[model samples]
Target chain A: MPNAFSRIEDLETTVVILSELAAAHEAEKALLARVACCRYSDAATFAIKLALEEGMNNAIKHGNKFDADKTVELVYDISEDRAIITITDQGCGFNPSAVPDPTVDENLEKPTGRGVMLMHAYMDEVAYNATGNQVRMVKRNT
Target chain B: MESSGDLVLDVRQQGSAIIVRLVGAVGMTEATLLGRQLDELVQQPGAVVVLDIEHLDFICSSGLGALINAQAKARPYEGQVRLARPCPLVMRLLETTRLTNLFDVYASVDEAVAG
Candidate 1:
């Protein structure tokens, strides 16, 4: 199975953005703009967009607190069997283990707290690296 | 770039299933396109629908909502809708929502069509 996976295909350029006051919608937009080249079903495309937006949204609002100087790094690695994408931020690391479950009935209407959950649900793998400053996710080529 | 606008929806009919191939972003803007397509299918009975999004790059919650909605609409008629070949980024969203198991994922349109 490992042999079937190929080296990460680097994106043409890193998509980086600086937002202010916890508004990272631009970053989310930028992230989505880059993912527009993926080979997925409409549902999957929506899932990826949601993940990217949610990731960027959390990075901006919760992590960096919307500091303009705090930039978000969006990297895309496209390959034949899979795409390895990573979202990194300059904010202080946090505890990924501390996130709450969003699927519970009471939490269903919450605007947030569901990004990580959703990411894990949609992607094949979702992992945290560098003490929570980075989120690396994988989507198989299936 | 607006990733949520201008999605191209193409429906290709195979034996007993319809392949709904979407190209571009499946964001808020294009979510409705999915709804419209599914609505058209709702009127037709007994045909499975497989959504093909390999050409799509980005997906949002609203977009996923549309799929869920379509699936729900199909359930009553004994017809099912499945997802075909989602991109990495798109897959990430499904995993995040824990919705990977909600819909059957296919490796290709042929596999889905054959099933």
Candidate 2:
């Protein structure tokens, strides 16, 4: 599984704003799918799609706590070698370190934390903003 | 082909076991509903829950969480959750999450229900 994402230069970025409604998830997925279809293989597309779903879900369900008044900020970008997705929620952030390891024996059956694990597994880089309300993931073309 | 927005969970009972046929995509949005359905079925004493994913095209980690939660909840009732015939994408997800070893997976629902 890949770990942290570092700042990089040279990119094509697009900004998107979505409501806190669950309906916004489909739009996010569709945008990701379009990017995947243009630049990635079938396997890569699946991984990216899964990562996007997990990240957006965390933002909507966990970060924003399903508060309809809030909004989700998404910055979608693609470089020559990788795709960068940054999602931010307008709620009190959480510490990613506090999340339990889902792979461990005691946590295997637990429902939580698996989404974060999958995001790390599929994306080459996963990073959180200081407050933890924002997550930036990068998937390498390779 | 089932679209991502459409998630159809068809549940049926055979003997003491319950079979859930999952179709389309199971993402975070649909996870709560799916979890609730699983919760209702697993509440029965000694219920064997079999998830038939032959038609399931996609499932996120949140969706996987629902399944694991059901498995945990059913354990106290002498019940178990089994997965049957997951598509390639779903199988890869299970492997990535290291959940493949946690549940008894069968090639078909019949084998899962029989066990």
Candidate 3:
């Protein structure tokens, strides 16, 4: 999918906060509440919640390198059909392609590097900007 | 030790196995605490760690990472981290990550402790 914010123009709710896990968690709670309010199934809510957590962790830890001074931006929209979320960090982005496949035999035991992979697995669509700092994920209600 | 939010870890010893009952969700913030707790438990010789996750409602990649870290730490001492009583969501996560074979999963706390 295209990384076009215009496509989700109706998703005007934007939240910008510090690069901290606590803050990101608050944002996640609020977004998940909206997903629930949209009447998504239990499984769909779980999937969205999981994907959101992984995306936020990547933005805060990998993208911003846990820089307290930096901030993470979250833009989201929830409807009966789908939930779309975009997370952007304020640090130099890395290459998403460079991340190893965590599902592989040798990498399965690795502790980290599974955030992006899980986001893709759970979400219907996952796309990153050219800089790889910003990620947009979508989950269909079905 | 219990965290302020999301996750609570209740650690107790059952025979040779150290059982950590995970209650609530384990997200990025809780994973650090989980990792530290597991690290300490696996220090014992031939430590067998059983994670009771019946009350665990949510877990993300970071939480899974903590479990993997514990398993890796336990391997050196011939220790192991086994999972027991995982909810459906957590089980789906394990299956999706293809980690079912990586960790021994039991149907109950008693079975895991005995195994």
Candidate 4:
């Protein structure tokens, strides 16, 4: 824990429901409006929204595991020419790099593995920090 | 602000193509589920399919990927996928990825079904 969190226009919100279905939709609306209001083109807004939804959904389902008591903190911020999204889960984290490559051969047939791939594709940068429980993603501010 | 997911899929005997009418947020979960259904449809002759998304609420890359994957699967059989009635969100996704040109998008399910 740091003494002070800086550089993030952070709004800490929690999703504590077990349904795990509408998490992305809820977060995406706010992100989309923010992106659109920032004078971003419709395409850029959609791309960022898509990427953020995937990241949040993963945080809730895999990172939080539908535990109602647990919370997923969503942070939205912008600096210079970049839009940043950070989602932190309170559950146990895993090896982010260990996930199989969905674009490679022998894995396309798998159905449940493309979320991270889509996040990487839509966002400018996708990286996991603090042992994979914290995902920090950015999309170019257009 | 409003989200709904009531999909009505009407199948037309178009020698090959099947049109799926989407009526909700075509997000990751539904996209994953649709992948299975579209997977089964691609095995048929000609392998072409059309998606009517006029009533679509939202679509992320996951949903877009499902559509692209369905199209790719159909291509081996000389079949293709078409789009119809893309809502604002759907259109945004397409235009963002520059996929609007990849598939033939129509304005209505009838057009897609007839195509």
Top DockQ model? 3
Off by over 4 Å in 3: A1-7
Looking at candidate 3, what is the lDDT of residue A58? 86
For candidate 4, write residues B1-115 as lDDT tens digits. Answer: 1223434444554544676666666665666777677777776667667776777766765676777778778878777778888877677556655566567888776777666
Question: Looking at every candidate separately, what fraction of the true A–B Cα contacts under 8 Å does it contain?
Answer: 0.25, 0.81, 0.81, 0.16
True-vs-predicted CA distance for residue B78, candidate 1, Å: 0.8
Model 2 lDDT tens row, A8-53 = 4334355444545356575566566667556786677777788888
How much does candidate 4 score in TM-score? 0.65
Error of 2 at A139 (Å): 1.3
Q: What's the TM-score of each model vs. the native?
A: 0.51, 0.85, 0.94, 0.65
lDDT of 3 by residue, A64-136 (tens): 9889889999999888888989999988898888989988889998866788888888899999999888898
- List DockQ, one per candidate, in order: 0.13, 0.69, 0.82, 0.24
| Interface RMSD (Å), every candidate | 6.3, 1.4, 0.9, 4.8
Ten residues in sequence with the least summed lDDT for candidate 1 chain A: A4-13
True contacts kept of 2: 0.81
Error of 2 at B10 (Å): 1.5
